[model samples]
Target: MSQDYSSRGSVSRIDASISVPVRTFIFSSLLWLLVASVLSLIVALKLQVPSFLGECPWFTYGRIETLQRNAFIYGWASNALFALNLWIMSSLARFELKSSWLPVLGGIVWNLTLTYGLIQVLLGQLNGFALLEMPKEVAPAMVVAFLFAALWPAVAFARRPTGNVFVSQWYIIGATFVFPVITVVAQLMLLWCPTLGVMQALVHSWFYQNLILLWLGGSALSAVYYFVAKESGRTISAYYLATVGFWTLFLFASWTGPATLLGGPIPVWLQSVGVVAALLMLVPTVITAVNIFGTLAPRNGIAQAWNNTTLRFVLVGAISFTLSALLNIVFSTRSLNALVRFTPFGQAQEHLAIYSFVSMVIFGAAYYILPRLTGSFWPSAKLVHLHFWSCAAGSLLFVVAGLTQGWAAHGRTDFAVSALPGLLAASLLLVGHFAFALNALGMLAADKAPSNRRSY
Candidate 1:
């Protein structure tokens, strides 16, 4: 007899099978988020007041910045994405996950390795590359741990009961396959073998761009597609365009890496090609934005749409994703790039894409996923609102300040005036991080309180 796990009522079963691993990932991610936020605050403060932590070697700006980036990417982003991807794939496949212990074990190893790697970074053993700072010795273990964590989900996707795979599944699967290859290859080339001269810069630049676009960007898009479709209860508009958009991103995004290296030692022709690729990225961006926005349009009413906190966050993130793409395209242009290349505009753009777009969408996904997994609603709408508003406001403040500083620094030689805006931006970001941590803690506490009360 064929095992039938595709019943519409199998959500509980799916949740049950995946809950342990999912919760593990989420809880660990939140904890890391708090740690990363503290690191970020320190990095921000150092920018404004260089002597604030100057006495400590571990607290130096370079080490702290590297630690913060690694923490956010590996600690927060990796765990959350794994959780989201697992849930999305399982739900779409209409099958309970098999061998859940694999992921749980994988998660334990992943976190342990991450902790060790982070400590190494703090001890000034950094690889001196953006997003690739995790030590080479630990790199292979991370890859192994990730594969361990990701294996079950990939198997579930392959053994999907449903033949009709959705766009979300496509993106998640693509990301799952792509991330490990990119990570291992990048580490080997840049960290282990050590590429020659400018080649190292090129590889580093390529790795960073691909990490953001293929892994983070792909995962964020998957969350957006899944949540927007589920919450809106609407079919994606121009569904065929999603295929086009996905292919466009997969094919062209790698080429956009050289755009960051414009005016560097790389060939002018390569930079020009990157510029074209970056500009062409707008195609997929527009396609995705239009498709998702159309699905998210008020099918019932505006008030109803606004009432859904998850949808609201996803909407904001979707908009930011589009805006980020546009900004990237504009900045890739020689004239605009020449103006903003040395300024805080680059940081502003990174914040917009990573935190505003990617993290916000993941937050929305978590909001939707957590309640179902725990069989409970969020503890407090007030806290949710606080988290949302603070993040939104702080991101806006941070981006605006960065842009302002970028514009101001264009002509001036002294950076004193420009640094003021960065200080303000950092303060706003700290407040936002506090709000996020508090909201997460409140949710966890609330989730646990009912059980404790029952026992008492």
Candidate 2:
């Protein structure tokens, strides 16, 4: 019953089976992206003009900022991952999802619960933790919903009919297992059961970093591994290095969280361990960079980077990953951490990771996955280009502004000087998101209008 999953000429059984669920997740994520972007714009505007929403309690910078970030993480990022990872795992395994209704149901529940949580956030009912800000009331439902959505991927991998396990599968499977564990532990320790004094911070830090690196970063890297090879028509160079990279990331990434509290109330030994673990992450970074860039080597990659939209996005994501990793290592150092602890540079590093590295890779994967799933080419090539540039430019501008703001901490006390770039970044990001939403929705619309659909 097994068939090769490599053929893209027609929708496979696997694609057919998962289509509704994947589409559900994708559309939900697009809606959330719009919500997050608007919130982001409001946040940026408030930064620039503090009195803009001063009268509204709901729009207060503190509350809205948390709302926007959570909306992005839980809403945009999580749903996108569900769609991408589901397709990737099922495609790689050549396994038809027997219970497609599971993910569809799960996606609905997840989004509905997240909506309620965000409302609570606006009402100031939050945990006050970075990245884990959603009210504890919503945690269990979201977790259960995620498991329902995510379980099929693991089943596909374990029950795969043929072929050796790919590196991308390794990352996906690892993430599927790791995320729930950390999320449960963090919620229990930080919210449900509650931990003692500094331990709460420690758990939050551990959970936060792993959520970024292992859960989110793991899924992004999985996409990168698959797309870079698929688009380049070349096997990942130095494939053995992938094992090293994957294992190193899985083992070391969890410990590196403590480094965020280097000078804080955390134990010195724990901080030192985090520092070492963070530095060790360099091993995987260099390994991944070599494997990816090496595969995209010579003139072929350069040409693909220009001609292939998927390759272009994946390549930029690869570059961003390297930069984010390097910046992470740099910031983990004691001297630099002391200087930039409470600064915008820290936020800038996060923006680079979430927006530039993870989001770009997901975008590239979506471009490839959606067309295959829908049996249609993108609605307009122009919209695709516009989305890419707007997002790329916006991400760069935000990161640049953050770094500059951090460095100018001593000299720049003026609000206008600090907030102007952020406002511009937010505006560009909003435009880019609109372009993406239109293009994505148009593709779905074109799918319905068979006369309008184009060949892949």
Largest lDDT belongs to which candidate?
2
List of clashing residue pairs for candidate 2: none
How do the predictions measure up, each by TM-score? Answer: 0.92, 0.95
Candidate 2, which segments miss by more than 4 Å at Cα?
Answer: 1-10, 448-456
Query: Worst 10-residue stretch by lDDT in candidate 1?
Result: 447-456
Misplaced by over 4 Å in model 1 are 1-11, 298-303, 411-417, 445-456
Residue-by-residue lDDT tens digits, candidate 1, 1-456: 132333422226677678778888888888888787778777766766779889889888888888888888889988999999998888788667667888989999999999999899888888778988877888789889999886565787889876787898888888888888888888988988888888888888788888898889998999998888787778888898999999898888888989998899988998999999999998899899878877766555335556888888888888889988899998999998988897888988988898889888988888887766665557667778877887787778768767776877776544555666556655665666666666666666556522321111
List model 2 lDDT by residue over 1-456, tens digit each: 244345544666667788889999999999999999999999888877889888978878999999999999989998999998899988888887877889899999999999999999898787779978888988889899999987778899889988678899999998888888998999999999998899999999999999999889999999999988877778888999999999999999999989999899988999999999999989999999988898888666767765888888888888999999999998899998898888888888999999899988888888888887777678888889899999999999999788677867756667567767888999999999999999999877666532322233
- Candidate 1, residue 47: the lDDT equals 62
Give the candidate number with the greatest TM-score.
Answer: 2
Candidate 1 Cα deviation (angstroms), residue 329: 0.9
Candidate 1 local Cα displacement, residue 189, angstroms: 1.1
- Against the unseen true structure, what C-alpha lDDT does each candidate score? 0.80, 0.87
